[model samples]
Target: MKGFSAFLGKEVKEQLRNYKFLILGIVFAIVGLLSPLSSKFLPVLLESLVDDNITILLEDPTYIDSWIQFFSNTNQISIIVLLLLFSPILSKEYEKGSLVHMVTKGLSRQSIVLAKGTLLFFCWTVAYWMSGLITWGYTHYYFSDSTAEGLFLPLFSLYSFGLLLLAVLLLGAVLFNSAFVPLLTVGGFVIVSFLADIVPVIHEWNPLQLATRNTEILVLQEGDRLLAQAMGVSYFICIGLVILSIVIFRRKNIA
Candidate 1:
């Protein structure tokens, strides 16, 4: 962990130089705006697009609808883009043999993992919150007659899931030297989680609950109980992944 602060600062500088912040901010901001706008207008657009004889009775869009769109967009759009964006973080360096100079210069492999992990979480937290805040503001403007009760936990659950993803991505980056390998690692992890959730007994402790149960969390339903448990598991697994990644990277042949 020596020089962790310096390494993290370097990571931030590189990200800024590459316009990573600009790209992430703009993308998440657009996604946030789209959530409320699409939720409010999609029903109207559908009605207009349908055939005149077609009788499609859709419910009026509400704050709940906007929030639903928010979560969906965050998951399907924002998170996917995020994983793709950072998928090459470590693996690309391996391909370039760029990390060898740093390692030869007394940089700890653990520092690389720690710094990159910190950078990943920091970027995700900021970008995700920006998106959520934007969605919240517009959702309120469009659905003025809405309650703010029970919002924090549900939103937090989604953020926690993003952390879980970064951890898996970090481990993938350490274990493999290809950018695509990390994505496949994350994909495999998600697929297994989704499959495991099919069992009622397993669903209670499954970390995927944090990502999939936002509406349930908002309602203080049985899922609320399960979400809390899942968040704990998610963090536990995230830590384990970080540790495992560091251990693997320390021994990995990055060249």
Candidate 2:
């Protein structure tokens, strides 16, 4: 924990100067706004595009529809951008030998790992909830019947899932010096998890459901135990990865 706070402050300031926060804020804000708006209007846009001779009947959009878009956009657009933006988090430091300089100047390896991990988690939490809250408010305004009684668990599951991804990302960044390799590491993780889900007994433990099954949970309110179990597993894995990264990083050669 030595110099953890100072390094975290440095990380925050660097992100600010680099416009990472601004870019993420804008991207998530747009993702938030688009959720409800697209749910409400995309049907009309599609219908209007059809020729007069074509008759298309689309179901009236609901708050559920809005959430569908929310999860979809967050998974497809927001998460992708977030990963790309931060994939080089540790790898770039490795490339520049900046961390070596800091290490030589009395910054502990533990502090660096903990500080960067904290930064990643903090950024993900803020941006993710910002998008969630925005969609929640707008969806309610547009559809008063949008009573998301079970929204919290689903949303929390998604948030927890992001933490899992970040943990993997941090480990990836530590193990690989190239930015793209970390991205591929995340991809490989998802692929393996996805494949593992094909086994019925393993599905309950799959963290991928946290990202993919939010809407189903919101609507039916089922799978509470499943999500809880998955969250527990994810937390355990996340902690392990961070620890592993710290160990690997401490022994890594930066010269």
* Cα lDDT of model 2 by residue, 1-255, tens digit: 548999999999999999999999999999999999999999889988999899998889999999989989998998888998999898778878898899889999889988989998998999999999999999999986798787888888888888989999999988888978989999999999999999988998888889989889989966678888788898899999999999998898876
Instruction: Give the worst 10-residue stretch by lDDT in candidate 1.
Output: 216-225
What clash count does candidate 2 reach? Answer: 0
- Per-residue lDDT, model 1, residue 22, is 91
| Superposed model 2: Cα runs more than 4 Å off | none
RMSD of 2: 1.2
Candidates' lDDT values, in order? Answer: 0.88, 0.90
Q: Which segments of candidate 1 are over 4 A away from where they belong? A: 221-223
